[model samples]
Target: MEKLILTRLNVLGHPGRMAVFRLLMRRLPDAVPAGEIGQALAIKPSTLSVYLSALCGAGLIGQRREGTSILYSARAQAGGEIVDFLFNDCCRGRPETCAPVSRVFREGFPDMSDRKYNVLFICTGNSARSIFAETILRDQAGERFDVYSAGTRPYSQLDPFALEVLKAKGHDISGLRAKNVSEFCAPDAPQMDFVFTVCDQAANEECPAWEGQPVSAHWGMPDPVKAEGTDAQKSLAFQQAYGALRNRILSFTALPLDSLDRISLQKAVDDIARETPEVTT
Candidate 1:
């Protein structure tokens, strides 16, 4: 830990490297091409190459090859740790000293707090899985987001078990009806910031182009409505679906949206689908 701290300090010790890192932070969650970074800082390409290499070696920044260009972004985890370490140690007894740093990190990037993100969850029938996600997100962070669910092939109503499990968990089951996805495709419809397909069928279907080009990913899960068995067995399926959607929605709402650019946010949401769900019934 000490070694990493010293390495970060040494990398940022040079003025040129410091300039590069500060510029990268201002563009958090977006990777800047090497040429663009050099141009922005008015540094010669040859000299800038040395600084980029040093920062990358210290794990302060990361690079990825994008076609012919190498793009770099400030490594958020590493940068965050350094800030945490400094704040903890320097302000050990002086808590007030940390406020300015906290304020800067909170307000430094593009402000996304004032706006509520519109998120739509989609499934084939919207009777179960999609409804579960909508309710879960609404329970989780309804104030920060506008959550909705729909189906490609509409169901006349929501699945009974889906409502049963939600009501058991104390989620508001009101105003939840299965609707066709077309309703949200109108010109006057609310623009979505995120769209998720929670069933394989909906994921495979061709979707209408959204107004804002929302970040989308598949969060496919087994359709609990199709689980055929005794009453207890069928109810267990709804519980499992609820658990899975609850876990995913919790993770989604916890993201630091203000600090993440669209590209990073897209990858983050896609990665959530790969994580194992924790059953919480």
Candidate 2:
């Protein structure tokens, strides 16, 4: 166990490798292409190759080939084990001594079971990624949230793969369609407590001022609609998007909203985008 921990530590001890690992963690559950990572971190391809190799060798990250791109992501289980070791060693089985850290991990959201919160998801097309988020949240916590989604430039129809994947998962696909952002910005539209942009374009676009000053964050992901490959591969992109959105929506809904102040709540929501937790199969 100690050797395993030492291996991970040694791999992260280098500054460049640490940057690579941290970048991967920020984009968790999304397997980033190596070239994209290099551009984001301004690292040369040759040096970045060494860093990626070291991380993979230490079992700190995993890579898979998607089309022509080799994608990489942090290994959540490995990271969890290292954290567990360090925390356990610090507390020495006296759980009470680790109370502060425990609270942070718990994310202590206040229980607001009585009233429903409004959530809106936005994307450029609204045909795939944002639609997935809306459906998942509605299905997962419909009783607690009044969920909606819209696009900056709405598509005429829903993506077939988006509908197929959700229906396959036994989620009702009825009444789902692409809608414009203006629909939600009207005088009588439902007030939103939270708004999330699920695509880079939507996040960058100037948004109409929402009524209630909703807590907003960018939960951007690749547009599955643009994915090119076989029908099976294209469908796989939607499936992956569905999985990632479901995991994030579950985490968001699980929070105790009644317990947190606006500042804490805002930070918590923002953190969700940054720390994309490991998605289970």
Q: Per-residue CA lDDT of candidate 2, range 1-281, in tens?
A: 88989899889999999888876754544568888788877899999999999999999999999888899988867877776776788677455787655543434443347678889999999999989999999988898889999999999999998898988999898989999999998999998888888986665455687875676776887798999989988888888888888878877987778878765786677678777653333
Which pairs in model 2 have colliding backbones? Answer: 109-256, 110-256, 110-259
Q: Which stretch of 10 consecutive residues in model 1 shows the poorest summed lDDT? A: 103-112
Q: Report per-prediction Cα RMSD to one decimal.
A: 13.6, 9.9
